[model samples]
Target: MTPRWTATGLSQDLPKGVVMAGHWQGHDLAVWRSATGRLQAWNDRCPHRGMRLSHGFVRGETLACIYHGWVYGAEGGCKHIPAHPALTPPATITVTAFACVEQDGVIWVAPADMAGSPPAVSGVQPLRSVSLTCDLAAVLAVEPALLGQDILRGTVQIDGQGHDVCLLVQNNPAGLTLHALCGVRANKVAASHWVENLRRRAEMKVAA
Candidate 1:
């Protein structure tokens, strides 16, 4: 809530021309990437009829609401109204836009106005993202310092050895969501299962 950048997801999770539902600091967001690979985040509600924009589709550089077909450009301004082909929507008819950027394969957003870049992680290749039915504190308690902050570094035991792992935590309504990045030579299957195990442990901690 202090206007700091927070991780929404891993970049690879959102391919070109895709819109994903994201949450930051209690605000619901519609995070989309244009066909040209430009990333943009906006309030999930449409200016027209208050439609959920995350249910909308992406066409070229614009996001179109499924209900009214109101097309919004990267700047979040309405570019076209299907009901009125010749009329250009006023500037006031725009979705609330947010600051978005990609760093270290993570898509981060600033719900409020902010200038700095998102936290960066080095030497970690994004493996996957998983949601846990527990709070951030629960996950942090499981791994402590290794997975406690914005950027986490630790090791997961695989085949009797340790593999380096990095985790980016996102607070969501469902609880804590984690974007995992593993070392180059790490076994993905092992890393994935390790994440599931962590989730179970964290959730158990919450239940206990």
Candidate 2:
């Protein structure tokens, strides 16, 4: 099967030394950036005890599980086991990792064997992400101009001006999320308000 990249989050949102929960094609992911700025996406569950690795903390170049402080290093291999300090963790104790990359201020994830780079969105800046209680159809119903399946692109009226906007779609269990981006020269505050307004309108349509 061909590999597809899913926009998981914005690059600025997942700074170094932080971890966040992400999803891709129904699989929950623990996406993190090491202290040195290495990006990684792994199965949310720790191999040792099934603890959500998203809750784990980053220590330098490794991710340590919050449950038992088991440290996973490069390629998701278990490097250290806090309980048995002297014992070297076997390679079998490894977390499942996916292909994670940051491009055009967006974080994209796919299966580990994914090959190509993520789609590019030039001349735009990252806006805030908003979760709507409705699906993509509701969004399109509200803004008929937006087009595309994964990366919705179009111009939105902001402050009486037409501003190019991009909404990266993320399908959540609850509904969905739109990781927004606006024209680089657009008024950020006004663009943000437009995003919220779009969410309200789309969700209200769903409710109706």
Candidate 3:
């Protein structure tokens, strides 16, 4: 399959020093933000002992594996080994890292060798992210208009006014997760309610 920058979550959802598990295409990924507010993405597996990096903690500019406390730098190289604090980790001790970026209120991740930047969107702010127990096709089946490679645009009506909303979708094994963004003139409450309704409809389709 062709690789592209996939939206993972809203920028506000991932604060500094936070780590979470994510998936892109078919690969399990570890997504985290350093103390300095930079986004990092890895294969979610530590080089040593094969522990999951997503279960690890972020300290300063490095991520420490919870199993053995082996710390890896932003470049995915092991920087510190707690068991051997006095010994420098070998240069070969490293984990696979990917390209990560945050723009337009969304966190994007791509393959390590993928080129180009995340698709751009303007004039909208992220309201929230929600997970649906369905595939991307089912999500589009609900409204059809909300179909796009990166950001999907649709309308939500509130107080008799049609407001524009954006949906940034990320496909995973469990289902499809989306970040909801609202236009400056959009109704936040209505947009949120619309998301809930969409989830129910899409998931209902998946179940049937």
**For model 3, what is the alpha-carbon lDDT of residue 193?**
86
**C-alpha lDDT of candidate 3 relative to the true structure:** 0.86
Better of 1 and 2 by lDDT: 2
Rank order by lDDT, top first? 2, 1, 3
lDDT of 3 by residue, 1-208 (tens): 8898988888888899999988787888889999998889999888888888999999999999999899999899999998898999899998999889889988888988888899887888888999987877777888776757656787756457877778888887878788888888877887788888889988998889
Weakest 10 consecutive residues of candidate 3 by summed lDDT? 150-159
All candidates in order of TM-score, best leading: 2, 1, 3
Per-residue lDDT of candidate 2, residues 140-187 (tens digit)? 999998999889999879999999999999888988888999999899
> How do the residues 1-208 of candidate 1 rate in per-residue lDDT, one tens digit apiece?
4677888888999999999999888889999999999999999999999989999999999999999899999899999999999997899998999999998889999954787778778887988999988977787788764755676788767656788888887888878688899988888888888889889999999899
CA lDDT, every prediction?
Answer: 0.87, 0.92, 0.86
TM-score of 1: 0.93
lDDT of candidate model 2 versus the reference: 0.92
TM-score of 3: 0.93
Which candidate achieves the best lDDT against the true structure? 2
* Residue 109 lDDT in candidate 1: 93
Q: Which TM-score value belongs to model 2?
A: 0.96
RMSD of each: 1.6, 1.2, 1.6
